[model samples]
Each structure stands twice: as C-alpha cells, then as structure tokens.
Target: MTEKSFAADLKLYDVEHLLLAETGEPPVSARDAEARDRVWEMAVRSNPALFDGPVVACGGVEWEGPRTLRLFWARVTYRHYALRRVPGAVALPSLFVNVLQPDTDGRVLAVRMSPSTAAPGRWQLPGGSVEPPEVGAVLDEATLAGQAARELVEELGVEAADEDLRLWAVTRGENGSIGLTYRAPARAEATLHAGLESARAADRARGREPELDAIALLADAAELSGLQGAHADYLEQVVRRFTAAG
Candidate 1:
C-alpha cells in the first residue's frame, strides 16, 4: 500500500467512540508455545529477574472512520512479544494507553522501566496494555480513563481524576504496537517527583521492585537523547508534538 493509502487507512477514535471486541483466543500456536518457553528461559537466564504475567494483546484493528476504530482483543502472556523475533512468525499488535504529563514548567514526564520488567531501562510514558473487560461489562471512554488513572496511581502514585485526561492521539509503532496517548493536566514538577519517590519506597517496602525506577522531565525532544537504553519509536514523536504545542 502506498504511504498515503496507509495513512488514510489509519483513523483516530475518541475513547468514548472506540469499539473493542474480544477475539476469544490468542494468536498462538503449539510451536509458539514452545518458542515462548525457550525464549522466556533465555531471557530469565540473562536477567534472572523477569516476571511472567498475563497481559492482553491486540488481534486486529478495523477502522470504520467518521471517528471510530474497532479493536479485537486477546489474552496473551507477556512472553508473546519474544515470538516476534522468531522467523516467519507474526505477533499481533498490542494496544496500550499512555499518559503524557507536563509539569507546570511545561516539561513532559517519562519513566524508566525497572530492571526486572520487560523492556528494562527503556523510557516511555506511564501506561499498561488494554485488558479484556469483565464478562457482561462494557468498554467505553470511562473504562479507558479509569484504567489510565489506575496506572498513574500504581506506577507513580499520582492520582488523576478520570475527567482530567483527554485522549489526544493514537500512535502506531514500527512494530505495529498502538499507543493511545492522552494529555494530562500539568502539575508542579516537585509534586510529581515526590509522588514517584513515595511510590518507589512503597514498592521496596513490600519486597517488590517498582515498575519505574527513574523519571525525567523532558523540556524538549532534544533532552530525550540523553536518556539511556532503548525507547519506543513513537516516543520522540509524542515528545516533539507536545513540546511544540506548548
């Protein structure tokens, strides 16, 4: 498909207008199961600290414009991402909600993943994968905003009201992962730092490593270069867009 055609095919949906359908089964094979085990073993051997957990991944995306996108969801373990490195194997894209917080000074907040997690040391906004809604439950704008708020509280100890989040953009990464980015109301930078520190201390007290070990405020995209390790390809774009808008 031409670049123009591809762009045209992509559409943004308001959280309220988004439609999500459960696929009922994950995109995995017996071979994939075996590969997942082997890859996970190798990964744990390398880090000796990785945790395996259930995570939801996307099965497919159907764009029905006029402001709507339908997402097919699946329950997959975190190991599924490793299968992407296997030759001739395709892993379905995962959808996640990312919240961009700009401090009162206009610097954007980014977090560094802990060493025990997948994508350790990478810098990205605070968020997690979209899980399947409860049986008989409805997934809508309120549900998504609630999830975003939960992440903020769990990961950074920042309590943001659901109404304070505005769905700003949907970004697709080079590997097809989708990020539903939201803009959060700005707060004092000191307040953000204190909340994160408290969250990290609480995690340590519970004998668990926090999901994020470091946080930085990017005054502009140029500061992003100073962060160590890999980053989601779309992160730079998000930073630039937010910084420019300010």
Candidate 2:
C-alpha cells in the first residue's frame, strides 16, 4: 500500500462550505439546466434553514451570539432530484471560516504553501473543513473561527486573539448535493502557539520548524492567484468574495 499525499486525503469538501453535499457530475441536459435554475433560484431566495438531514443541515437553523451557532430547524430541502442518495449532503448545516489577516505592510493576510500541500507554493487563504457537533468533528462554526486565529499563530508563529478577529459574512454555495458557506476577517500578525499537532509534525518530519513557512499576507489580489491546483483557485474565489463584500 502507498500513502496518499496531504493533498490527496485532503478532501476539499467544497460542498461542506459551498454548494456541495455529494459528488457526481453528468452533462447538464437542457431540462436539467432549467430545473437547476429553478432549484438554484429557490436556494438563493430560501434561507439557510431549509435543508437538514440527520447528518447535514439544509437550512432554517438559527445562529446565535458572536459564534454563529445554527440551531436546528425543519422545512428541509427534501428534493435532490439529481441523486438517489445525497453524497456530501448533510442533514444539518456545517460550519467553516475564511481567515483574513494583515500583510507585512499590515494590509492583507495572504499565504503561501510549504510545497508539501496540494496547493504548495500557491497563494491562498487559510481554512479547512468543519464537522458539526452531531458528527463529532472537532471544528464547528465557533471552533473554525478560533482555528482561523490559531492557524494564523501556528502557521505563522504568531499570536492572535479570537476577539480581535472580525466576522465578515456567511455566503452559501451548492455543488448539486451539499450547500453552506462562511467568510471572516482578522489582522495580520499574532503570537503563535504549536496547537496544530499534525501540522507541526508534518513540518518536523520535513526538517523544518513549526510555522517555519506558514501563511503571509500577499501583495494584493493579483499576487494571490499564482498558486497551483484547486487551492489556488479556491483561495482566489474565496478571498475575492470576502474582500469584495467587505
């Protein structure tokens, strides 16, 4: 057996945050396109509390406080006409965050990968998948925000407090199966703590110290897209939306 690259098992799970719940691709028929438009329109007009499976949240969940806690609700989107079973579709809404920080000039907190990642050497915003409490995943909405700040510290060897971070806004995208999204902002530098054990280990194995080569603010939007793979595109789209709206 062979080991998969970090990028391999690194499941992008875009549907976890964007418009994705499962994975399947077929040529969109004219009828499919028309139906998709209708569904997409319904999704756009509908609140985030419509889709809730035992596993994923479809919409109508109430979020409370600064943490964005989405309490469960009903009136879920029970119709996924595309698949017999929803792949990444969750009964409950999952949580995730987009990290924003200042650059060396205190402008933007863009980042470069350590080349070990699938998007190695590309510029991207720091983020990850979120597993809600029901699934027993470590990261939730609030936790993801904290992780954003923590990732700043560990990846850059800086210390940033959760309070100082700013909440941008949550946006939703669906990949035909799953549906959800979140975006936030924060400062550039902070006091780093070796909180991410696996990330630190990966660095150590490579003979580099933790946060040795983590995220850094990019010069601007143009410099951010130079990265390779899905990560680069992911960062570009996410950051653009985040900054544009802000």
The lDDT leader among the candidates is: 1
Stretches of candidate 2 exceeding 4 Å from the true structure = 1-95, 104-106, 115-122, 131-142, 173-202, 205-216, 225-234, 237-246
lDDT of 2 by residue, 137-200 (tens): 4333455457566655556544566766555444443331122233333332442223334467
Q: After superposition, how far is residue 21 of candidate 1 from its true place, in Å?
A: 1.5
Candidate 1, residues 84-184, lDDT tens digits: the string is: 77777777777788898889998889999988777789999999886557678876667877888888888998999998998877777756777778788
Candidate 1 to truth, TM: 0.86
Judged by TM-score, which candidate is best?
A: 1
Where model 1 places Cα greater than 4 Å from the true spot, the runs are: 1-16
lDDT of 2 at 173: 36
Worst 10 residues of 2 by lDDT: 1-10
lDDT at residue 206 of model 1 (Cα atoms): 99
Q: What is each predicted model's overall lDDT from 0 to 1?
A: 0.78, 0.42
